[model samples]
Target: MSSTISDPASDGVVRAADGTPLKQRLNRALRREKLRSFLLILPLLAFIVLSFIMPIADMLFRSVENQIVEETIPLTVVALKEWDPASGEAPGEEVFAAFHADFVQAFKDKKHTRLGLRLNYDEPGMSGLFRKTGRPSTKMQPPYKEAFIKVDEDWGTVETWAVIKQASPAYTDGYFLNAVDAHRTAKGIEMVPENERIYLFLFGRTMFLSIVITMSCLLLGYPIAFLLASLPLRSSNMLMILVLLPFWTSLLVRTSAWKVLLQQQGVVNDFLVWIGLVNDADRLIMINNQFGTIVAMTHILLPFMILPLFSVMKTISPNYVRAAKSLGANDWTAFWKVYFPQSIPGIGAGAILVFILSIGYYITPELVGGTSGIFISNRIAYHISTSLNWGLAAALGTILLALVMLLFYVYDKIVGIDNVKLG
Candidate 1:
């Protein structure tokens, strides 16, 4: 006789003595599987939190922070409680007295003076004010009001007091406003001067360049993606490897190569002149300009656009286009009205990826485009490293982040990000 095994589902082999259903045993197994899956995901969750989330949070904090105000004029901030921001006039003499005291103390402490100078470097005329206040001689006198009055005489003026009253708070929105081409005055909002304006221009240029490059990539990449998608699997894979070959090269090397290719004495210029395309080599404005940047960036970023499009195009059935053609639609109409619309997800994803990356790029623009073509990120880096102005750098970074977020939000609203299906 064959040995008979009890069926867990039918015979309830794991049932409790109280006669509970074998369903409980199945539930226990299911829960164990779920727990094991969660355990497997735990490390990834920790990695995301530690590596990405925490650093972003720290950066955001640094962007809007006002530590200088807190440390420099603690007493003034406390004393100016009665001063109303809405009233928009100078605070009482008591606020000035507190400032005087703080300045005197901070002046005596060389370290604190240096800290104040560093913090205020971004603000126009602040370096001078800090230097004046941070002097050792400025500390020797009790209540340095006389010295302060001598420097500007506005020290006693309502406007001077108003400026201090406005700036006295331990926290501020000043840096943020300045970063976005907006300025906060006693009256209202206004545009910054052209000479003083940097971020706004860079931001606009960055956006414009990114859009142009993305469009160029889309126009060029779409045909290539379609060709690859139509090919056999083996042929398509080979083509894909060729398309992705640029990724193996270093970014700097590629950019430098473009520089060499586009220069006045380079092959491109020689060909143009030889082919009688232009009367002179000087006619080709290829290097150290927007054209150079666009060419190099589009070349570097083309793979990003192509891969998504290729993946999307591959999934789309060729029969749909044929079906549309059979219904008497022209080939171009069938493609535009049927096939192209289906490729929207890939287009959106690739455009967004390239745009965001392009805006933050510094090296290519700095190297090939020169001072005239520098982006906001270049200025931010300069402020941090050369000027040693962390506050300005943070403020610039915050503005860039906000703009990128705004762009993402607008894109999401127009076409839901969730709708994107990447193979």
Candidate 2:
């Protein structure tokens, strides 16, 4: 027999050629793989942080920032610290003198417009009030309280000073309060007058419309998804082309097409006239209303609902339904009892996606939603562009972001995030 030799590597302690342990060599291999994977994803990670994360962080910071008053009226802010509006005492002569100097400087620097705009959010009409008073500020002399009151008797009241005092801080929740349709008063936070409380209504309408659109998409998409999943391969592929055709078209183009199709004198009304459905003189009011929003959004988002349901339904074995039917179960009973529960993951995924997208929609609503049907996102855009009230816009955006995150949290808890499938 040939001499048998024991290999040191096989006995118990394996080693690399240079005598390094095999365990260390394997760990080094794993480390290389981890580094390579991280390197491959670094660019995408950086992009997400810079584009999505940073902007949202900046908006959250801007929501609570309140520097307009402190910057414009530095001396007035300092002088008002000792004064108490709740004490029912007017600020003394020194406070008036300091305010006079600060207001004059602000006027000369052309910062009065910004100051007025900021204050007007807290106390309406302050913009015009400041613009009117700023022009005559130079004519006022010492014993300035009387002279300032002459510019506007409202200046002598404690209520006016209370607004100024509340706004003195460099950072505050005043914008958030305004976003919720409340005001900071001497007593504390209180709701604005009934006529002025519109933000809460807009928020409620946005959520309501979003739910309606999601439900509409579900109702229309379920049967189509089932048909697509159940049909023969060639037919399913052809139908899928139609379902995905909208993605090839521009969103603006689709919205504009709807506007043309739904207008009073457009194809829909003209067809109704031709069919003698009703008199041609009184065409239905469809576009630029809630009906238009619901219809357009349902069409645009229907594919999202269908794709998820189709992905889930395609994986479901037909044998389950066949087995149930062989056991004397009706088609409806088999589907409701056996098929629907398994398909719920798709429903949750699609509903959350559609609802979230609908809440933040601006261009669609702006294009077709008239004043009555406009969303809260439209209001955010108005404040951002037309009103130039970035603080309020940021506050509104932050609130909306919070709401979306809360929905995701709830969905994750109820359905388990792992169950969400988006093929």
Candidate 3:
């Protein structure tokens, strides 16, 4: 038990009972502890990567991915590279011959329709041209230019080949350009026609409405939160159940209930008629517009605002307001200067949560928000499910994500994220 090794390393150092240097043993133990900690968190890390990171990565990749045109007509793309779009005429006979090969092969494989769709996004009539030419393209002779013109006049135009050359790249910024309501043409990047400009307006509307919803929640929830914080324990607990009652119900059910209440002949209109606020025949139109979306969403998101404000207010001591009043400050001055300032962290936290939720909310906006009120998210959903344009959907989603991140960064810089308190 008293044996000691005469090792150089352990001359003046403490040793373990097994005669190993204590410092070496401690370093080994520390490494083991670190590895154990990493092992414990490995499952959560893997879950985050698989569920969140991978999908986002795939979306970013798809945003700029445009391989369908190139993959469908490789020889045509190569042939058209040297053809000048400004020639004010169709590509040469040789170029048409190159495309003739790709056209026949793609038709045989039944991929010409897909290629047509990809090109149709840039030039509208290409889909019909490709589909109409599908079968006849097989019987075309060596003089493809004359045969193509005979089949369809579009094949004899420069606009047709220009779109093909533009979309020939394996990867492109076309989707992102389209996301901002612009397009890449043979000339250069330019905004779409005024009638086609939608994405930018929707983006602005989404941000504006989200802010309005956040402000509405704050204004309505603040007083309630203050009352909750000031009330006696049993009464506050009972009041809190009322606040939390909406959470117990399904979101769809709650939105549907709002629909029944806000419709033209619904309970709200009936009540207004009874109160003589307006004529019975002149019922308000509120159910399927911006107003309805704001009302329904504010009600749904109010709890998010109230809970944080209440939690923070509950931590603020009553004695601070009392001390201010004792120092000759009026009741309003004391409450405003001391108590309200103290509760700002909660306001910040609640605003962030509600705004973020409102911006991304699709179901509520889709249900209550008719044509004029739907958010950009609704358009993204339509692209993904209905249009099946994953590229455009991914670009829109990436932009939305970037917008949220930029706002978060600005908020952090202005308000200091560390100052926000949930409790």
Candidate 4:
């Protein structure tokens, strides 16, 4: 009577009615569930990998993938490896012979000119030197050094040979270095001359303008969002339409409209003059400057900020504020202590959205931002389209990506990304 009943599974060998261990059965079921979940999301995963990850990875690789020179003149690279650039003279007959062996066909195939153009990014005369030496370099005999030197004295200079050797590697950090306004030379890495140091300035301007735009959106959007959330269902739904109206129109059209409005003689300045706030003779220089870029971008991105804020604010209970007020808190004190903290998640979400979008935006900035306001992205576009310097463009893009990621990390650290929510 006093004996305790033996517990089922006391031996830790629980089994199903079919005599299978329950743990094993549970694990098998979990495996099937995991497989099913993975299959459901497989399409989305593939789309992200193909559309976003692959393209970004390719761009990142292109930042360091500088194989054209190595591929075009393999023999010259090998010959020059043993030659010392410190000697203040060009390589001897062996190096000249190796270069000539490859130069004729490369020039004929137009590969040499492309290589020259690439090398010329670092060494100014390389493109012209390669072009001038093309057909004539083919006729030069065993004493290739003397013949090449007579054709172009630049060919005999240590600086010229040094540049080629520097560019001979299949992969390089030169593009990235140049992106930060530095260059690779016989002196190792050095900052470019002050006048040529424009990329850093553009980076600074891009970051500064992007911050200004984000702050502008936040300030302008918070009130609209609070108003929308505070309204009744019917009124809020009607007001929401106006907030979304911008999405129906073309972005280019909006930017162009801003251009028309912000131009010196455009509607904005014309109205200001009419109101006598500004003199007609001294119209504000709005278009093609930082002010134009900021105003246009802030207007364009404000809706993005408002939507997030509204969604989160709508979820917040007005009861909390009422309770604080009932507990003897003043209107301002209750809002500052209770309502603002709860709305911070919305602020975080909207700030991240507007900031990231504003940082990468080139179209709006390009149209409104002139020489002074143009961002690093504009320079990236220039290198890609006009200069065909894809390496530099890729490097600049990679740097921008890193910068955005850094800002995200900082925000996460400061505000806690876990606290950021749209609703």
Native-to-model Cα distance after best TM-score fit, residue 89 in candidate 3, in Å: 3.6
The lDDT of each candidate is 0.75, 0.89, 0.90, 0.89
Structure candidate 2, residue pairs in collision: none
Instruction: Select the stronger candidate by lDDT from 1 and 3.
Output: 3
Residue pair clashes in candidate 4: none
Question: Over the stretch 80-176, how does candidate 3's per-residue lDDT look in tens digits?
Answer: 9889998888899999999999999999999999989888878788899999999999999979899999999988888888889889899989889
RMSD per model, one decimal = 4.7, 3.2, 3.2, 3.3
lDDT per residue for candidate 1 within 1-423, as digits (tens), equals: 111434344543555545665568778879999999999999999999999988777767776676766576688768877767566554556666777787767776655555445445434555565676566445444445565666655455554445555665556676677677777666776778778787778888887888888899999998999999999999888887888788667899999999999988888988889999877826687888888888998998888788877877888999999999999999999999999999887788778867877888888988887666667888888987997766668888877888788878866775577855443
Measured by lDDT, the strongest candidate is: 3
- Once fitted onto the true fold, the runs of candidate 2 whose alpha carbons sit more than 4 angstroms away are 1-13, 410-423
Per-candidate TM-score against the hidden true structure: 0.82, 0.93, 0.92, 0.90
Give the per-residue Cα lDDT of candidate 2 at 397.
Answer: 93
Candidate 4 Cα misplacement greater than 4 A, ranges: 1-18, 279-282, 323-329, 409-423
- What is the lDDT for 323 in model 2? 93
lDDT of 3 at 165: 88
| Cand. 1 Cα-lDDT | 0.75
